[model samples]
Target: MWNGDGTVEVYGFRVFYSEVDCVRRIFEKYPETATNIRPKNQMVKNAYMNNLLDLIDIICLAPQELTEEELRNAESQLLELVEVGFKLDWLKNKLEELCVKKKKMEARGARMRELDGLIMEQRRVLWELETELKNEENEAVSDSARLGFEDVV
Candidate 1:
């Protein structure tokens, strides 16, 4: 089934099968659990279907696939589980990393907001100071001119 984002979920496994022929061939070749097996009970086939459903559930609950950094270390694990493997640990670790990153990003965003507020406050204070300075200079010039200092020019 298409996952709506160009990804396909075949036999409950998310496979990046873009072409139809490759997907069809994989299904046709692996007909046991890969095809012709409904997730729901189909008569006495319920036993097999139940087992398949459990496997799918395990896969879904399992950790994400290995990253490029861990791919070498996970090769053997992946090979062992080709037919039965679920990367639960990898998925869990990735999720934890994501959570940590998200928290850091949120903290950074909050800090930036605080800095913005401080900058705005500073701007307001600077504007008031400049206005006061300008008024004081104007008054000084007017007072000097009124005190018969006009000829001093």
Candidate 2:
């Protein structure tokens, strides 16, 4: 077992060369079991779990080691961060869409204003032409009356 100060201690038993070779083979095949007291398959599974916990702890601490509970808490925090990032991306897209729509609306409004001004100018010209036509008609009628054209009604 490893002490907190980076030293390993084995209990009152001598390690055999054959056992060491077997342990080495097991560790090579399944590196996760290397940290267990007895390198059995079950211990290897537990060691894998412990290593996963340690990785979580390392990620949580950034520069230090963390406890198991801290690692679990960090998982939730990471999830929250991911959710926030997605929400931000969604909001950004919405804002961009709104901006494009607003620009289109402004452009259409400008075009409408231009068309209204053109229509007003055209109406003014038509009115002037109609007044001239009325004056010409009245002049012709007066001329015809002076000329005494009885059939020119």
Candidate 3:
């Protein structure tokens, strides 16, 4: 419904002049028949369908705009809109970014596993060296005791 100012309410969402001009054309085509709301509503829907990408751009690509919560809201809207057959041209870019991030995380995980294996091997080698040193000390003490006993005899 035309609000008599410069806006039309379409499906509970208000469409303003700044956002789209197609709905305004419907007003111009049927200026005197505001009472006949069906045509206007249909035209509003057509306008929305034609400008779906523009809506996505506002919700997803607005510059320096939308807070974290707002971004989440936009994400929800985008998902809903896509379910309704809305297509986004920039989705390929987002997919590429996510793939690159996944690769980086996998590389980091591999590096961590390698470091852990090296640390375990180093600890094992150190324990073996300590055991050998103790064995050598015990042998030296036993040999010295045998020499003392022989001298005593």
**TM per model?**
0.44, 0.39, 0.39
Count of steric clashes across candidates, in order: 5, 0, 0
Q: How would you encode candidate 2's per-residue C-alpha lDDT over 79-116 as one tens digit per residue?
A: 44334321223323333444455556668879999999
Superior by lDDT: candidate 1 or candidate 3: 3
Among the numbered candidates, top lDDT falls to: 3
Location of the lowest summed lDDT over 10 successive residues in candidate 3: 30-39
Weakest lDDT window of 10 consecutive positions for candidate 2: 7-16
Query: Which ten-residue region of model 1 has the weakest summed lDDT?
Result: 78-87
lDDT of predicted model 1: 0.50
CA lDDT for candidate 3: 0.55
Q: CA lDDT of 145 in candidate 1?
A: 72
* Local accuracy of candidate 1 as per-residue lDDT tens digits, 1-153: 776766565555544455445545534654543333333433333343334333333334323343433433344433333334322344344445544555566689799999999999999999999999999999998887754567666
Number of the predicted model whose TM-score against the real structure is largest: 1
Ranking of models by lDDT: 3, 1, 2
CA RMSD for every model?
Answer: 11.7, 21.2, 11.4
Which tens-of-lDDT digit does each residue in 30-125 have in candidate 3? 343133223345555545444444444554443334445544555565555455443433543453344455556668879999999999999999
